[model samples]
Target chain A: MSATEGFLHGLQLAFTPELLLTALIAAFVGTLIGVLPGLGAVAGAAIALPLTFMFDPVVGLVLIAGIYVGAQYGGSTGSILLNIPGDSTAVVATFDGYPMAQKGRAGPALAITAIGAFIASTIGLVFIVYSSGFVASFAITFNAVDYFALTAGGLLILARISGGTLAQGLLPMILGVVIATVGMESTSSYPRYTFGNLDLTLGIHIAVLAVGIYGVSEILYLIEDKRQRASYKKIRIKDLVPSRSEIRQSWGPWGRGSILGFILGTLPMPSATISTFVSYRMEKGIARNKSQFGKGAVQGLAGPEAANNSAAIGSIVPVLVLGLPFSAVLALMISAMIVHGIQPGPLMMEQQPDLFWSVIGALAIANVMLLVLNIPMIGIWVRILQIPRYILIPVIVLVASMGVFSVSNNMVNLYLMLALGAVGYFLRKYNYSLASMLVGFVLGPLIEDNFVRGMRVSQGDPAYFLSSTFAVVIWSVVVLIVIGAAVRTLLKRRAQRRLLDSTAK
Target chain B: MTLEPRTEHEAEPGGENLETPPEEHVEGRRSGSVVFATLSLVLAVGYVWMAFDMPNGTSGDPGPGTWPRVTGIAWVGISVLALIESLKVVRTAPADLFPTGKSLKLVAFFSAATVAYVILLPILGAYIVSSVYMFYVIGLLRSKWDIRGGIYAVVFGVGASLIFIELLQVRLVAFPW
Candidate 1:
């Protein structure tokens, strides 16, 4: 279908009163969970996913997608107002967004983020419509080696951008790959790391770990490092909503961030999180008012916020076409699709156009609804922050532990949760990020199975990995990035030494 | 932290001696990192050997060991990274450990109650286990310290319990007794 037709069709279905109401509710709930420090979009999406099962798959997908979009937008709200970012992507926003709030420009900062996110999301949706077919066609050509290379390239960037040394990022990634190996090996009939325990042989659930890391451990972390018991002051509602100038200024970053975000997000790693950080850095490096960046540049807040929401939209291309989950939330969303006997791949658009179009419609509506709902309600959310940390954290911990344990009604899960929590707690202590580790855990099996399958076909010819044009292209990119990183570090050191020598002379 | 940070437990002269097993420094790194790494290593090694022993994966597929071997390799690789990290921090970084007394007490108290709730679920059914667990955990986290707060904690907890059991309708821990 044409882009205009797709846009009009999605708008027509989504604007219907009942669908709009359902989306608004989802947005509200998603925002609530996403605003909380310990909870994140993945948890918000997963917990809310099963609830949507009772609805028709189309409606269910819409509501679920709504929650997904809302959570991304809502996460920015917390970071912009309070310094505590709800998710990792939200961390970048806090650098300027919260600073703006402290400077009584909370209104403009929140305004840019809310409006920026809405505009970027729209641009991203347009890309998904125009490019999904192309990506799907391209994906049909992906073999194991090509897939492996792409995954590696995405992962390398993820590790490289997570701050600190290459060793720092690689360390967590390796740990994750190992952790994912704990359950059954996907290819071999034999179980790998179950340790003779039947429950564990099934392996640790990715969802549970997400909860423990983002939900449980974070609560524990916040409790330990209580950053001011209350918000500095209430942000005026007008400041939370974008003004005309804020909207006008948003155009440059919004357009650049969204388009760039869409491309970066189609990769296999933490696409949404990475795009946000990179977009923020780009805005700072290029903005005319560079000095205002961390001191509260609305453009800094706007660019990354837009990029992240747009990246969420960009992620759908891979999910819709290749069946490769671009992020963890997509993994669970794919799992949910599996439950409904719907396979996610290139044929899905043709197979289920109505479902496809309606969900897109729902997502577009969800973004608008979040901006509409959240801007006016900053006062209410600020009160939520005042709920007394002593009471709030434990309540969250109680609910999270309860919800997870209830799934199997097994204490084994509880023990696992606690065990994972303690593990999560320690991982944080040593500054090892939990995000990539989880990515490894989930993708390790898939990566291994595919790599081995490719090898056997080549009869142990390692060069077989370089066989296909797609595989070759992907691998070339991976190799270039790795080599580039190494060269960059060497050059940096030389530059530093030269500068030091000149100073001495 | 407020009081001059006393070492929680000094074991042997590892910190004092230059040749302490190196793990002595690392041992203080969160126990989770090591355990996860070990788990990954065992998984990777076992899978590689298993796939190696099997004939060319399953029918028309890569050998059974093929996938497992990669998994095992990744496991070993990642675990080695984590182990190195934990070791580096323990040896090189000045150690900062221990939760505040309040955090520790709450974690310990909640943990014990949860264990009890798990034990009681089969006998008590989903409702009672949830009610009991939620009520106690909420109280401990709050530090509310008043009868009115206690009543509110139980009441709000029950409200949550109702949402889980009635609204969501999933069977939580079914109490046995």
Candidate 2:
């Protein structure tokens, strides 16, 4: 079947009454976490990820993917109305969204952003719908050595480019590889880091570690801060409605931003700061009210919002196709897939078309759901902001701790979560980038084992990477990413210095 | 080609003039971060060293600890660089750092309560061990006063016990001394 036909079929499945209801629930719950500043989609997906173990991996993955997109859209609710960016990505929304709110134009801001997110999301979903099978097919052919080279390339990209200290990034990751080595050598029956404990026979569960490090640490974050008392402001219900002129103005950016966001989000080396900046600049340059930009431009809000959301979609492209996660959050998503016995890569399209298409379709529905729900539930989303953190975190902690505990019924897993929580706390304190470390922890084993095994098979001849033209092409691309990021950073610094000097004169 | 709008504080990112240490009062304390990092570095290096002795690829070939050992060394190397960079006292209160003391104490108190639960689990059974432990942990974190905290603790504890031990079929030691 053609890719378009496949997407249409997936849509038919997604739009069924049962799936529709599920999408709505996912959006509502996702919005709840998204609007609450400290909580995020990653945490939301994870907290709910364990619950999906009993379900079909495709259904489970779709639900989580819906929540993932839904959360990004909902996050703007906090940023626009409350003036607090829900997460780093949503920070740009506040540039114009808050200003719109302050002017009692929050309705238009909400409408436009929701509208923009939905449009951008549709664009991204369409991209995934077409490309997932192609990408998945490519990954199925990766032998151990090819897998190794890709892993090494990915590790370096994740480490150097993952937006934290290269050293700090590798620490937990390298430690994880050592930890993975503990139970037994995967190929041989030899034990390495077990310290001779009988329980060590079974390797550490990456899921439990992710649940603790990413999931539970979030609760710790909430507990450390003063509980957020939901506060309300001048939110005129009328503000939820957008003017015709406003809608017309927002349309262009939504289209442009969707394309921009998709590319940025998909790239291994992100242009996060710039994607928004570029969108903001592009919209402003073309916008009639150019001078109003920085003051309160609606286009400013639409462009960046589109860019970031598209990037989120873009980020998923590589994962569905190649079984490679360019970011930490995606790494966790890959883990979730692994737990369900559904390996993602090229073969998955033929092996599990239902899963691939459902995920893409689910994202599409999530965006539509966001548009449908954003305005009517503005009051509900706003009200949820006031839920006290004191009560919230304990429940969260209880759920996470209990989830980890129940998985293996291992009393040891609960204790492990506690210990990892402390280590995470310290890592945060030092401004060491947890993202790279997380990326490392997730990708460390994949890269190391694959590269080593592949090397061994090649008998130290590095031409193993070149035997297949595909490997050569991928490595070359990875090399380009590394060089580009290096050059970009250097140039960015130079530009900043020159700007500073010019301003000084 | 365009500029990112940055906050003033973010500029002069690495200039020593931005955060000169109070050398007189806090010399050793200031150095603690680096010292701790170095110690971790040593430990990481040790792990890598041990990895070196690990057997390389079998007859068909797959080296035992080659990847972990190499990664460990790389990790150590990265730490050394970060240590030097971090010593400057940039004074930017980086977000996502350690919690304040009171909250930390409460966090520890809950952790200690869990430890107590682990110790008591075999002796007291799943229900009893979890019951008292939950109550104690919540009380330590935030006392709602009176029976509210108690109610929450008991409810959660009971829910946990049934879900974990009864429904999921975890082995719950029922015998207590």
Candidate 3:
């Protein structure tokens, strides 16, 4: 179907009463998830996944998409109100947002965040809707060699930018690829790591892995730390509307952030956090009086929040077009799609056009719903933080277990969930990149499949890796990213040495 | 490219930065890196050994084992690099692992209780098992337990029933008997 036709049909599906209610419920859950520290969009998706099973496929997708999109907007609440980031990406928001709250402008900071997220998501969605069709069409034309190059290049870029030392990120990624190879070898149908256990033949379900990592591990992490809940200042709806000066200061940052976020998100990396940081830095650099930064600067609040939401939408583009998940949350979405027996790829747009368009439409509507829900309910969101951790954490665990068990009604998956949860907990403690591992797990099979196919086509010529111009371009980009990281690390070490030497002298 | 995103004021997973003495902090980090790298090296060696046992078809006709072997080699190379980098850090200072006793105990108990709850689900059913598990958790976490705490646990465990069984129509594993 054409983009316009798909969109129109999606409008029809998304606006239906059942799906509209699903959007509202998802937005509500996403907002709540965003309000709590240590609970991210991935966790929210995992916890709420079981509930979606009862709904129609489109409605379920809409709900999950809504939660993912809404959580990004919702995270600013905790950041602005309590100096706690609801999402890790919102960490940048706390620099300016908390200060605004301290200065009696909490209302305006939140208003701008919500508004920024709304506008940026709309802009990002427009690009996604228009470009996705083209991406899918172009992807369909690509052969095995091109596929191999793109996926391999994407993985390399992901490893480099997975938000830690390259080695730290690559370790988890390698582990994920190894884990992906556990149950059954695609080529020979031979079990590699199943240890002769029949239950392992079906492989670890993606939902099981996701729920374990995001849901159970997060609980484990939260329980280990004893943190006092932040006190909330009573807020009124009237206080949430932004002032004209604040609104004026926000427009330029919003525009710039949306563009930057979309472009970065479309790239094969974890873009939300990176985009927010980049937007925050860009705003700081361009501001007339930089001292206002971290001191309730509206531009600081505006740009990062806008960039974050835009990147959230931008990340969905690859998931739809290439069936590649760049982040943990997107991986869960793909798992949800797979659960419903719908494969997410370029062909999905062609074969399941209505389902595809409805998801896009649902995300667009979810963005609007967040703006509507957040402004009036800002007071309630603040109050949500007041819920005691002892009470809340138990409920989360129960829900997590139920969600995992509900997927297949098996007890072994519960065991697997616990085991992986332990792995995730330790990985986080050691500052390993869980997101990189997740991306690796999702993309590992695709990479191996494409590589094997391309090799078969080339008659196993090792030189086929660099044969095509496209392959060469991809490899060049991969090499450049690696070299760039190495150079930066070296420069940093040298700078540190010079500083240390000067201090010693 | 400059990947040091964790500046002094940046919020990490647990919100507050660890406020160890400067020397201790540096040494502690080095020890942590070394430990992780050593563990990764062991795992990589095991994986590579397994890869060696697999059938390696000719380059012209790659087998299922071929890609795993390639990945295994890559893992070894990177693991060695990681070990070297970690050793460089360790050269600066060496510190033993620090443990917060209470927190570790609490985490271990919490994890164990969860495992027990899941194990008992088929025998005792979700309602009874989760309610007891929730009660234990909330009681353990909260300093002074009130009857209301038990009520809350019961409600949560029962709420799972209402949603998963009644609302969603899932035939959750109940009493095995």
Candidate 4:
């Protein structure tokens, strides 16, 4: 189907009563998860995985997508209200948002955030509609070796970009690949790490691992912290309306941030976080009154908030076109698609145009729904913030456990989830990036499959992997990424040393 | 290129300056890194040893074990480098990272309770096990047992059971009887 035809079909699918209701509920749930401090988009997606299974693949995907968009909207709430970021991407919002709140302009900050997010997402959706087909057309030509290069390059880039030392990122990712090898090997049907357990043959479900790592681990961390409850003044509906000048001030930043965010979001990295930070820096750089930055500049809040939502929408492009997930949340979306027997690469556009277009349509619908839901429901979200940790903790744990169990009705998964949760906690405490690990796990099988296939086609010549021009280019990019990371680390260390020396003087 | 956006705050003109890590905290982090590196090295070695038993095909027709073997070897190298790096840093971590004794106790109690709940789930059924687990955990988290906690736990347990078992038709063992 043509792009226009597919999009129309998607719109038709999205408007169905059942799908609309699903999108609405997903938006509310997503926002709620985002408003909560510890529960991020990854955890929200993991918790909702089982419930999605009950719906058709299109509806299920829409639900997941809606939740993601909703979470993006909700993530700013905590940052604005309490200076605590709901997710890493929302961290930028806290720079200006909390200050605005301190100045009794909390309502305007939130109102502007919702408006910026809506506009940015709409802009991003337009880009996806126009650009995805072109990208997929190019991607369809990728051979096994090229695919191997792409996946390997993607993993290396992610590890290099994920915060902290390279080893800290790589070890967890390698561990994820090792975990992927636990079940039967696809080519030879040889079980690599089953260890005589029958259940091991079935392989670990991605949702189970996600729930364990993101959901269960977060719960443990929250329990360990023993943080005091956040107290914020009750916000009324009238308080949500931003001043006319505030809205006018947001326009320029929103346009610039949306464009920058869309461009950056297509890369194989933590696009939302990176885009928001870059947008903040750009806004601050261009602002006439720079002193207002950390003191509640309208541009600072508007730019990053726009970038956050745009980057989120932009991140979906690579997933849709190349069937490669650059982040953990996208990986979960891919997993959902795979579960429904829908292959996600370029061919999906042709074979499952309805599914493809509907997802895009649902995203648009969900973005619209988020605007309608978040503004009026700001008060409810503030109430969610007031929920006692004790109550929220048990509810999260129960939901995580139930979600894992419902995957295949296997008790073994529950045990695995608990075990992984403990491991996740330790790994997190040590500053290892769990997002890298998850992306590794999701992409591991594909890497192995492509590697083995390329080897077979070449009659076992390893050099065949580098024979293709595309493969060579990808490898070069990977090398450049590593070199770049090493240089950055050295510079940071030098800067730290200089600062320390000056302090001593 | 760097996604560590929080670090940008340090460069902000009027941003709150991030404090340098205290000596004790730095030492604690170093020690923690060393322990983690050691554990990772051990695990990597174990994985490599296991990979030895699997059949590795020729370069042209690599078998199922080839990927795992390569991954294991890479892991071993990374872990060794990490261990060396950790050893070079001179610092000592805290005896325990947990903030207070009570926080540690909460984690331990909750962990043990969860394990027990999972074990008893099949035998006692979802409703009973879930209700008891929720109540106990709620009280543990609040650091007090209360009637309201009990009531919420029961309601949650029953509500969850109904939704998953009856409404969704999930094949969970709902009742032992």
Top candidate when judged by DockQ against the true structure: 4
lDDT tens digits by residue: candidate 1, B113-170: 7567656755676556555565566667666456756665666566666776677665
Q: Model 2, range A1-505, lDDT digits (tens) per residue?
A: 6799878777877876767777878787777877887776767676766655655676666667667777777888877777776665677787888788778787788878777877887888888877766666666677876776676666666555543433444455555555555567666666776678755666666556666666666666666664335456645567678888778778889999989888877665443434666788788888888888866787899898887777777888877887777665677678778888987877777778877777777667777787778777787777777775545655565556555655566767766666766665566554444555556666766775666666777777667767876677767876775566556655655676688789999
Query: lDDT tens string, model 3, A1-505?
Result: 6677788788887897877788888889888898877788888887787667766788878878788888998888877887777778888998898889889999999999999999999999999889998899888877777777887788777877773555766777777777777777876787776778887877887767877877887787677655676667788988887889999999999999999999988887878888998999999999997999989999999999999999999999988888878888887777677778888889988898888988888877777789899999888888897788887888888888877777767777889998888777766655667877787887788888887776777888878877778888988998888667767766767776788789999
Q: Assess every candidate by TM-score.
A: 0.82, 0.85, 0.93, 0.94
In model 1, where do residues sit more than 4 Å from their true spots?
A7-22, A46-60, A152-204, A235-247, A405-412, A452-462, A482-505, B1-60, B81-100, B173-177
Chain B TM-score for candidate 2:
0.67
Model 3 preserves the real interface contacts to a fraction of 0.37
Which portions of model 3 miss their true places by more than 4 Å?
A: A50-55, A498-505, B1-21, B55-60, B90-99, B169-171
Best-to-worst ranking by lDDT: 4, 3, 2, 1
Model 3 DockQ vs. reference: 0.33
- What are the per-residue Cα lDDT tens digits for candidate 1 across A1-505? 8656866787787887878888888788777776766567876665555455555666666776777777787787667666777777687888888877777777778778777888888899888878877776777677788777666555555544442434445656665665666666554556655667888777766556666655666666555553455444667765555667766767888888998788887775577887887898898888898887888777788788889988888887777776666576776666556546777777777777766677778888887888788788877766665566655654565566556665554557766766677677766665555556665565566676667777667777778777778767766765665556656755765676688789999
Q: Would you list the C-alpha lDDT of every candidate in the order shown?
A: 0.66, 0.67, 0.79, 0.84
Write candidate 3's Cα lDDT for B47-153 as tens digits: 87887777766766777787788777777777777677765532222122223677777777888898898888878877788888888998888865679889988
Residue A80 in candidate 3, Cα distance off native in Å:
0.4
Where does model 2 exceed 4 Å of error? A15-22, A134-146, A168-173, A234-238, A269-278, A281-291, A466-505, B1-32, B58-60, B87-144, B148-177
Once model 2 is optimally superposed onto the true structure by TM-score, how far is the C-alpha of residue A98 displaced, in angstroms? 1.7
Q: Pick the candidate with the highest lDDT.
A: 4
Largest TM-score belongs to which candidate?
4
Candidate 3 chain B: 10-residue stretch with minimal lDDT: B1-10
Docking class of 3: acceptable
Residue ranges of candidate 4 with Cα displaced over 4 Å:
A491-505, B1-20, B89-97
Total residue pair clashes for candidate 1: 18
